[model samples]
Target chain A: MRATTLHGLKDIRFTEVADPVIEQPTDAIVKVIASCICGSDLWNYRGDNDITPGMTMGHESLGVVEEVGSSVSSFRKGDTVIVPFCHCDNTCPNCTFGAQSACVHLGFTVSGQGEYARVTQADGTLYRIDADPAPELLPSLLSLSDVMATGWHAAVAAGVRPGGTAVVVGDGAVGLCGVIAASMMGAEKVVAMSRYADRQKLATAFGATHVVETRGEEGEAEVLELTDGVGADAVLECVGTDQAMRTAFAVARPGSTVGIVGVPHGVQLPVHRMFRKNVGLAGGMAPVRRYLDDLLPLVLDGRINPGLVFDKTLPLAAVAEGYQAMDERTAIKVFLQP
Target chain B: MRATTLHGLKDIRFTEVADPVIEQPTDAIVKVIASCICGSDLWNYRGDNDITPGMTMGHESLGVVEEVGSSVSSFRKGDTVIVPFCHCDNTCPNCTFGAQSACVHLGFTVSGQGEYARVTQADGTLYRIDADPAPELLPSLLSLSDVMATGWHAAVAAGVRPGGTAVVVGDGAVGLCGVIAASMMGAEKVVAMSRYADRQKLATAFGATHVVETRGEEGEAEVLELTDGVGADAVLECVGTDQAMRTAFAVARPGSTVGIVGVPHGVQLPVHRMFRKNVGLAGGMAPVRRYLDDLLPLVLDGRINPGLVFDKTLPLAAVAEGYQAMDERTAIKVFLQP
Candidate 1:
């Protein structure tokens, strides 16, 4: 099978690799129908994160179960399902607490950008779809594997209350999705911070009631002004940079929380300021599996169109182009057809 | 009037000062009957925090209202009241949100160790008891002004739940009170991290179901072992040092929050580790004014005895000795009477 593999910096390639097989009794072979690039992937593609010579990439996907190990009971061959970015044993202590991202037997769903991928902990990691949906719903369904659920996690962690205000710190795919989550969760006002014209349009479409085309202190001031100078009741920090984190705290109201979904790079939290304002920090890696049940019905009913984040789609063989498009800011997200 | 004042590092003295009066239209002068040395005060006493020479000391006190300014409405002269350490005009946005500590018109109740203390925001800061209580209840009532409320804030912020496990790091007056808070909030297992035998006994008396005498890795291991290797559902970080913060996070279960009330000094939060585990950090300076209503009844009914934290009592003239006793850990806390 040809899969997306990273050799080094700025070098993503569609190369031949051995086909995925059942490696454990809890593993199942998935024939991936669709997958996409995550903002987190850019870290390794830009040399920010060290890369191995031939590590398989992609942790988001929706597919048909090609085969299942004998021990797998909840899913079988021909079943369509969404694979969470992280696999977990649902019965683990962390998973029982709905923090599946920190599951004791956690494993990443790598190799998803391929013809076939082996998913471990199949019963606990895969969310089965009752019927194979139309092609148009594929992208939205694919988002449940990671991005959309991650955005929802941010809103939930931030405690976005109905009739309150929410501020989203980043304008990336996850940030746009966060706008949707906050609005869907009933935040009366949703503020999106963005400088790009294209991303701003998407943010507005995804339920951003206000858009601040500024950064740093100026952006914080704009958000404060929007909230009658009281600051946002909830804040979603989708960018992992220090400046982004700083802005999130600066604009958070007293007793409010800043839910951070971004993977931190050079961020140092303003602990003193957070202490003074009673602003809390929550959220980390999203427990995608835990949110699947709530989000799937919304997606199936067309209540949310998270798939709109995928502004570009390409064949799996053009994986290199996909990475470059995202790296160059030409694409919000690139959906890959396997 | 004679009051406790800080002259320099470790130099506390009872000296003559101007008598406190209603300085603002909203001010109320309270004749302090009972006051106490707080663990936080020792920071200035030990030189960890910069000391302003001749600064009037003390923020915890309960007394009779001696005078009320023209605009003071809720409190009247001769009324017995609990003056929160921080005075807030509870009408501010922050105060309305239940974070009176960050109130727009926030002011610290300094001079609380004096014969009379001028408390600003009288209408919002003073909680009055129906009648003058017996002398025996004075110490417990004084705790409602700070320590007890601060401990309750930690538990509330940590989201202590019924049938859950809670871990409290630090065994100072506030941490000892946190044991009572966790137990009162219905945590089935309340663990107190302490090394001193006296503090351990007090913690047990305050409802600590378990105590870990070790520090660092050994302590974390013991807590993990006690919770069946899962970790506590809620954790109260009562010590502001980095190590205490680290242990609070280390023993917190996934999706649990660590409530921090200690004023941070030389502490750097582990943001990366927090992100990976989904452990949240919340709480700050306790909003004593906000919690007064709920805690006053509990104290009035004799449901809790947080006053036990004050192991030694001294006349206000012996203010110097109170500081030394607390500095040397010779007393858990010292209650001062004028």
Candidate 2:
């Protein structure tokens, strides 16, 4: 199978790799139907996070199960399923509390950015789709495997509710999807803080009532202005940067919460400021598993189109171009067909 | 008027100062009935926080309303009241949401250890006790002015639900009172983390199911072990230290909250750990004004005895000794009758 591999910083290649097989009794092999590069993928691609030669290129994916392990009761061959980026037992303390991202038995399953992948704990990690849909729906369904669930996780972790005001910091695909998630969660207002025109449009399309083309205090003031100086009721920190996290804190109203879903790079929270405002900060790696079942139906029902953030699509061989477009801010996220 | 003044490091003096009068249309002059030293006051007395000379030391007190400005509608001369340490308009956006401590028009209202003190937003800040409480009840009424309310705020902000497991971090008067508040709020198990014998006894009396003489990670481990490796449902942080904050995080169950009410000196949070655990951190300077209405009735009804934390008392002119006792750890708090 040909797969995208991260060999080094700014280094990626389409290389022939051996097909994946279930090594564990609870594992299942998936024929990757759709996969995409994640912003987190850029973390390793940019040399900030360590990556070995021939490492998996992506985590967001949906595909057809080609084989199931002997102990896998919930999945079988030819089943269409969504895979949470992280594997979990779904019965552990963390998983039961909906913090599957911190599941004690969590680890990365088979790399998604390949023609074939293997998933562990198939009964707990795999979510079968409602019904087999058309190929055109693949991108959107595949999104539920990661990006959409991630965005929903951000909104849920932030405690987004009806009549609540949500400020989404960062305008990448996950951030834009967060706007959709917040809107779906019944937020009265969704303010997407984005500087780029294209991403801003996507954010607006996802139901952002307000778009702030500013950053830092100015962005916070814009949210406050929209909220009549009280600040947003919920803040979703979708970009994992010190400044994005700071902006999330600045714009959240006192007694409200800030849910951060971005894969953190180096975030030393300004605890003094948080404590002073009585702000609740909660978020980490997206508990994608917790959100898949709930968000997938919304996508299938046409209540939301999270795939709008996928502004570009290409064949698997053109994956490098997709990465470049996202790197240069020309695309929110790209859908790749293998 | 006799007042406590910070003269230098480890030095406070009872000095003669001019009696205060109503300085604003919303102010009320009160003849000080009693004032006491707070744990935070020790920070200034110990020279940890900069305090200018003759700044009028006390922020908590019970007093007689000597005079009322034209705008003081609820307060009048001859009224006996407890002044909240924080003055609030009780009408700001933040205050409307029950965060009166962060009121937009918030102003400091400590009148020092003096004979006469003035309170701004008097109509809002002064919680009038029944006409004239008996001399025996004065001490308990004075406790409602700050520490008691501070503890209540910690418990309330931490979201101690009925049947929840609660841990009070810090053995100070506020922490002990937090045990009382959590129990009052229907917490099933209240664990008091204290090393001091007297404070632990007070915690036991206040409704702590378990009192552990533990600190830092050891304290967290004990709590986790006690709760079956899941941790407490709520934690009240009454000590503002990095270690205390860490303990709060470590002992909190997933989806639980940590209410921090301590006046932080140099507290840095472990952002990464907090995010992964899905812990909620909410706290601020206690909105004493908000809790006074709910707590005063409890104190007056003999449901709680918060003033038990005051181990010693002194005369008005002997406030310097009160500060010294608290500063030197000889007393948790010292009440000074003015």
Candidate 3:
């Protein structure tokens, strides 16, 4: 089987590798149908995150179960499924409370960018699609594995509700999907903060009622001015940088919540500021497994097109090109067909 | 008029001061019937917090309305009212959402240690008691001015639910009161963390189902062990120190909330840990006004004795002795009659 592997900074290789086998009684082997590069992948690609040579490269994918382990009762061979980024037992206290991302038995199953992958804890981690769908629906279904579910997590975590306004920070695919999420969650106004024209356009197409082409203080001021000085009712921090967080806090209304899902780097919260405004902060690694049940149906019915985030698609052999295109900002997200 | 003044570190003085009168159209003058020394007040008295000479030094009080400005329609002479720690217009977006403590027109009214206090934003800041009660009821009613409301805020903010377990950090009056608040809010088990025998007794009396004398990592292990290694459903952070915050986070079950109402001094959140656990952090300065209407009746009807925290009381001229007793840890809370 050919799988994507990371050797060093900026080094992505698609080469023949040993096929994954069901090592554990609860594990299953999946034939990958679709996979994609995530923004978080860039952290390792850019050498900002520790990366070991020949490491498995992706965490999001849609696939067909090729083989089920002895203990896997929930899924069987040939079942179309969405593989959430993290693996959990589902029956653990955390998973039972819908915090599968923080499950006590959580395992990072980041081998999605491959032709074949082994899934651990198959019964709890795999969400079987109800029926077979066309190949064109792969990208959208694959998104439920991580990115789309992550965006929904942000909106829900921020407590987005009817008649409220949501301010989305970041112009990446997750941020764009967040606009869709907030809108679907019944936010009357979805404000997308973007500086790039293409991303801004995508944001608007995804239900952003307003777009702010500013960052930091200016961005906060713009959001405040747009909301008549009361600030947005919910701030979705899809970007985890300090600047994005500051803007999220600044533009949040006094009683609003800021849901942060972006992998935080060097982020220190100003507790006093949040305290003074009575603002609440909640969001972390999203429980993608928990959201798959609700969001997959919308994609299946074509009510939402979260798959639109994939601006470029490539064959498994051209996986390097996919990484290069996203690295240079040529593609918001790149879908890979295995 | 006689008032308590801070001249320097450890220098508390009962000195003659000019009488206060209503200055703003929204102000009213109240002749204080009861006031109390707060843990935060000791910060200035102990020189931990910056203090200006002759600064009027109290924030919690219940008093009789002596005079009102033309715009003060909420109260007139002889009316009894609970003066919350902070003054707010109560019409701002923040106040409208029940976050009066963060009101846009917020004014820190700290003259409760004096014989007379000129209340600003009188209509919103004063919650008038239906009738003047006997001296015995004064302590409990005065508690509505700050401590009781603060504890209630912690419980409410932490999202305590029926059948859930709540862990209260700190043995202070507010923390003991939090035990009561969590119990009243339907928490099946209220765990109070205390080292002092007196505070533990008070905690039990205030509805604490269990008490843990351990601190830091030991305390966290104890809480986790008590809950069958799952941790508590809600953790009330009544202390602002980083260690306390960490313990609060550690004891919180996945998907639980930590409500912090302590005046934070040196606190930096370990966001990654919090995120990974799916633990939420919320709570700040309590919106005392919002809780007054609901809690006052409970106190009045003897359903809750929040005022039992006032273990010592002193005459107007003995304000120095009141401060001394609290400073030396001889009293849990000291009520001052002026």
Candidate 4:
């Protein structure tokens, strides 16, 4: 089976590997239908995160169950399902509390950009799609595996209220999806912070009522101006950089919360400012499994086209190209066909 | 008039000063009836926070309205009222959003230890006690001005739910009040982390179902053990130190929030752990005015006795002794009568 592996910096390879098999009684083999490169994947490619030779790459995908362990009861062979980036025993205390990402029996959906991938805790990790949808829905369905659900987590964590305003920081796929989530949650105004012309267009299409191309203080001022100088009712921080977090807190209205989905990197939380403004910080590695039930129907009904974030699509064999495209900012996200 | 003044570190003087008079069209002069020494005041006395020589002290007080400006409408002369530590217009965006501490026209209720204190934003800052209550209820009523309300804010921020478990980190006056708050909010189990026997007793009386005398990992383990290794559903961080904040997060269940009322001093937030566990940090300088409506009735009805946190009482002339008792940890809190 061909799978994406990282040897070192900027070295993503579509190399041959043994076909995935059930390693545990709770495991299942998934024949990948569609997968995509994530923003986090660029961290290792850019040497920001340490890489091990031949480490499996990718943690997002939707696929058909090729085989299941004898212990698996909820899913069987040939069943189509969405795999959340993180695997969890849904019955665990964390999972029951709607924080599946922190499940006591947590596992990662790595090696997903492959012909076949083994899924641990199969019954608790996979969400079965009831109907076989059109090919056009595949991208949206795949997004529900990670990015879309992550964006939805941000909105929920930020407590985006109906008729309120929301501000999304970052222009990545997750940020774009957050605009959709905020809009779908009934935010009267959705503000997207992006500098790129292409990303701005996609942001607007995804329900961004306002777009601020500026960054730093200027961007914060623009957002404040848009909200009658009071700041947004909710803020979605999609980029985990210090600057992005700063802007998130700065533009969050007093008594509002900032939903943070971005994996923090070299970020110093402005605890003092957050305290003074009565702004709260919530959201973490999103409990994607928890959101699947609510988000799947939205995608299936075409109420939200989160798949639009896939500005480019490529064959799984061109895995290196996919990583490079995302790294070079040439693609918002690169969808792959296995 | 004599007022409490901080001459320098450890130098508190009850000295003659100009009588407080209406300063702003929104201001009111209140004759101090009951005031208290707060834990934060010791920060200045202990040289932890910079002390401005000859600076007027005290922010917690309940008194009779002595005078009011032409624009003061809600409060009248001779009316007894609770003066929240912070003064807010209550009509500002932040105040309207229930974050009066961050009100756009925010002001502080300083010189509250004096015979008369000027309160800005009179219509918003003063919560008039509708009926003339007995002297016995004065202490409890005065607590609603700050500590009690601050504790309630922590519970509200932590989202204390009915039938849930709550862990309060810190056994100060505010933390004791938090126990009252958690129990009132219907938490099935209230855990108070304290090393002092006196504080533990007060905490138990205030509704703490459990007390852990250990600190750091040991304390965290005890709390985790109490909750079947799942941690508390809501955690109130009443101590501003890093250690207290760390314990607050450590004992918080995944997907729960840590309500922080302590004014953070050189505390480093564990953002990584918070993200991984889906634990959220909320609450800040409490919007005491926002909580007055709900808490006043509790105090009036004898449903709660937050004022019990004040273990010693002193005449206003002994202001220096009051600060000394709290600074040396000889008293949980000292109630001062002017």
Candidate 5:
């Protein structure tokens, strides 16, 4: 089998590797049909993160069940499925409370530009898709694995009820999808806080009722003006910077929640301000396992097209350039067809 | 009117001040029968706060309505009432949300310590007792104005549902009262985190099933063990300190809330950890206006006795000593009989 390997800064190569075989009774081998470059992937590709040598680089995909171990009961060969970024037992106390990412035995695969995923704990991790989705829908369906779920989680944690006002703080694909998620969840007013004109257009198309171009205090002020000074009922912080966290606090109404889905690079909350206002906070990595049951349907029915976030496409060899396109803000997301 | 005027650190003195008069159409002048020292007041007495000199030092009391302005319709002269710390119109958007503390046009009672509160926005701020409370019941009923309500708000905001486990992270009057409030709100397992024996006794009597002498990581471990490694379903943070805030977070389960009613001094939140677990936070000054309807009944019905928090009592002229006693930890709360 061939796999993508991360060697050093901007250095990724396709190399011959031993095919993955099930070592655990609960494990299964997934033949990857499609995968993609994530904004988070750039963290490792830029050598800005703790990247181990010869690391497999991704966790987003749609695939077929090439094989399953003896103990597997719910799936078989030739079954198509979506692999959530994190693996969990789904019966742990954490999973019961909708926090699958914090499961006692969480697992992940680094076979980014891969031909297969050796997913452990298969019964609880993979979600079978309907009737082998068309090849054109492969890229879109695969997104449900990570980014879509992340965006949906942000909206869900923010309590974006129907007619509720929601504000998304980041312009990344996840943020864009969060805007769509908020709308799908019945939010009547969806505001996307983005400075980029291109992303802004996509955000409006995704159902954002308004777009504010200001940053920091100005942005918060614009949100207030749009929401009639009451502030948003829910604000999603998709960027984990300290500044983004503060902006989330500044734009939420008293008693409203600031859903923060961004993986923190470094964040120190404004407790003094948040505590005084009774502003609540709820967000984390999308518990895609908890949301996929509902999100998958909207995708199948065409009620939502979260795939719009994938603004670029490339072959397996262009993975490095794919990372750069998103890193340079030239593309929202990039798909890799192996 | 004679009020306890704070001049400097530990420098409280009784000084003659002009009695309050009707300042607004809804304002009512109430002659205070009794008042108590709050934990937050100690902040100023210890010179740890930025309160100005000559400021009257109390926000808790039961009083008699001595005079009513033109628009005061809920209470007549001679009525006995409890004045919430915050004065609200009961018609603002904040009031509708049951967040009277954040009320628009909220009026402050500057001379809060002495008799004669020029209680503005009387309708929402003053709760008239069906009958005048006896001098003997004043102290206990007086606590209903602030600390008890504050504790109730903390528990309620933390989402203390029936049969839930609630951990209170403070053992002051408010913390102990939170135990009573949690039980009242249907919490089955209330854990009072306090080291002081006297406070522990009070907490136990108030229905705390467990009393753990916890102060940090060890305290968190104790709580997690108590809940079988799941942590408490609700956490009431009644202390305004960084350590207290962190403890509240550490002791709550995923999908639960950490209600903070403490006047935050300098609490830096662990946002990353909180978001990852889907924990929610909501708090502030007690929205006493929202709880008085139910809490006052518990007080009147004798189901709750919050006044027991006051271990010492003094006449109005000796309020300076009362403040000193509370500051020195010689009193849980000082009851000043006017």
Candidate 6:
């Protein structure tokens, strides 16, 4: 099997790797149909995260089941499915509560970027579609593995209710998806923070009612002003920088929530300020598997087009170019057809 | 008028001061029927907080309306009322949304420790009962001013639902009130963290199903064990210490909330941990005025006895002794008759 591996900063290569096989009774081997580079993937690509040389790189994928272990009775070969970023037993206390990301017997895979990936806890982590989805639905189905679910989690945790105002704090792929997620969740007004014209267009298309190109305090002021000076009822922090976190808190109403989904780096919360205004601070590693049962239908039926985030697609051999495009902001997301 | 003033660390003096008079058209002067030494007050008394010399001390109060300005239309002279610690012009966006403590035209009164207090924003901050109640009801009515309201805010913010598990993280007056609040809110099991015999007794009396006399990690372990290792669904942080805050987060299940009403002093959140598990961090200054309409009935109907927190009583002249008693932990709360 061919797989993408990181040799060093900005150095990604497609190389021959042993095909994955079911090693446990709970495991299943997925023949990758489609995969994508995530913004989180850039953390290691830019040398920001500790990247071990030759480590396989991807966590999101849509695929077909090649084989299942003896104990895996829910899925069979040729079945199309969405594989979540994290694998969980699903019967654990955390998984039972719909927080599969924090599952006790957690299994993670970087093999997602490869042609054949072994999926542990197949019955729990993989969601089978009633039938093989159309090729055009692949991007949206793949997104259900991570980004879309994460974006939806941000809106859900922020309590974006019907007729409420919602604010998205980033313009990345996930941020654009957040605009769509908030809209789907019945937020009357979705505000997107974006300075880039291209991303702003996508944000608007994804259902952003307003767009503010300003930054820092000015941006916060604009969001607050747009919400009648009371701030948005729910603010989604899609960018985890300290400034984004601060703006999320600053632009939320007293009883509202700031749901942060981006993996935080050096984000120290303004605890006193959040406390004083009673703003709820929530969201993290989203339980993508838990949300698939609900969000996949929207994707399958074309009620939502989250796949619009994939601005570029390439063959498995062009993996480096895909990463380069993402790093240089040439694409919101880059799909790799395996 | 005589008022309790902080002279220095551990030095409280009952000194003569100018009588409070209406300074705003929205103001009302109240002859204080009762005031109590709060656990928060001890911060200044113990030198943990900056002790401004001659600063009038006390925030909680229940009293009779002595005078009202022309604009004060809610009450008549001699009407008994509960004055929330934070005086807010309830029409502000924050107050209208049920966060009176963060009101735009916020007024804080420390004059409750005095013989008479000029309540600002009288129509918004004072809740008038139907009529003067029996002397036996004074203690409970007086508690509605702060501690009881604060405790109730903690439970409400934490989303304490019927048949859920609740954990209270402090053994002070407000913490004890939290146990009662959690029980009143329909939590099936209430766990109280206490190291003292007297406080433990009060906690059980207040409907604590279990009591754990440990601190920090050990205490969190006890709570997790009590809840079958799933942790509590709602954890109330009544103590502002960093340890208490950490334990509150540690003992809460995923998708749960840690409601902290403690006046935080140098508290830094473990943002990464909290984010990973999706534990919501919420609550701050209780909007007591907003809760008065709901909780007052509970007190009036003898459904709750939050006033049992006040174990000692003293005249205005013995204000210094009241502070001393609280400082020495000789009394959970000290009631002062002005």
lDDT of each structure?
0.93, 0.84, 0.89, 0.93, 0.85, 0.90
lDDT of each residue in B1-338, candidate 3, tens digit only: 88888999888888888888778899988889899899889889988887789888788988889999998887899998899988888898889877899888787667899898888999989988866688899999999999999999999889999998999998888997898899999899899999989999999999899999998889889989888798999989998888999899999988778998988878998789877877888889999888877998899789899999999989868888888898888999998887
Which RMSD values do the candidates have, in order? 1.0, 2.0, 1.2, 1.0, 2.1, 1.3
> What residue pairs clash in candidate 6, if any at all?
none
Give one digit per residue, the lDDT tens place, for model 6 in A92-153. 98898777888876787677888988899999889888566778888888889999999999
List the candidate numbers ranked by lDDT, top first. 1, 4, 6, 3, 5, 2
lDDT of 2 by residue, A258-281 (tens): 988887768878777776677877
User: Highest DockQ among the candidates is held by which one?
Assistant: 4
**What is the C-alpha lDDT profile of model 5 across A228-258, one tens digit per residue?**
7888889998988888988988998876888
The positional error of residue A327 in candidate 3, measured at the CA in angstroms, is 2.0
Q: What DockQ, between 0 and 1, does each candidate earn? A: 0.85, 0.58, 0.78, 0.87, 0.61, 0.77
The positional error of residue B97 in candidate 1, measured at the CA in angstroms, is 0.8
User: What would the per-residue lDDT of candidate 4 be over residues A178-268, giving only the tens digit for each residue?
Assistant: 9999999999999999999999999999999999999999999999999999998999999999999999999999999999999999988
Compare the candidates by lDDT and give the number of the best one. Answer: 1
Candidate 3 ranges beyond 4 A from true positions:
none
- The order of the candidates by DockQ, greatest first, is 4, 1, 3, 6, 5, 2
Q: Write the per-residue lDDT of candidate 2 for residues B273-306, one digit (tens) a residue.
A: 7776777787778888888778878887899888
lDDT, model 3: 0.89
Per-residue alpha-carbon lDDT of candidate 5 for residues B274-302, written as tens digits (9 for 90 to 100): 86777878777777788888987787788
lDDT winner, 2 or 3? 3
lDDT of candidate 1 vs native? 0.93
Candidates in order, TM-scores: namely 0.99, 0.95, 0.98, 0.99, 0.95, 0.98
Model 5 CA lDDT for position B315: 86
lDDT of 3 by residue, A263-330 (tens): 88888887998888878888789898898778978998899999999999999789889889999999
Stretches of candidate 5 exceeding 4 Å from the true structure: A17-23, B69-73
For model 1, how does the per-residue alpha-carbon lDDT over B244-302 read when each residue is reduced to its tens digit? 99999999999889999999988889988899999999999999988888898888899
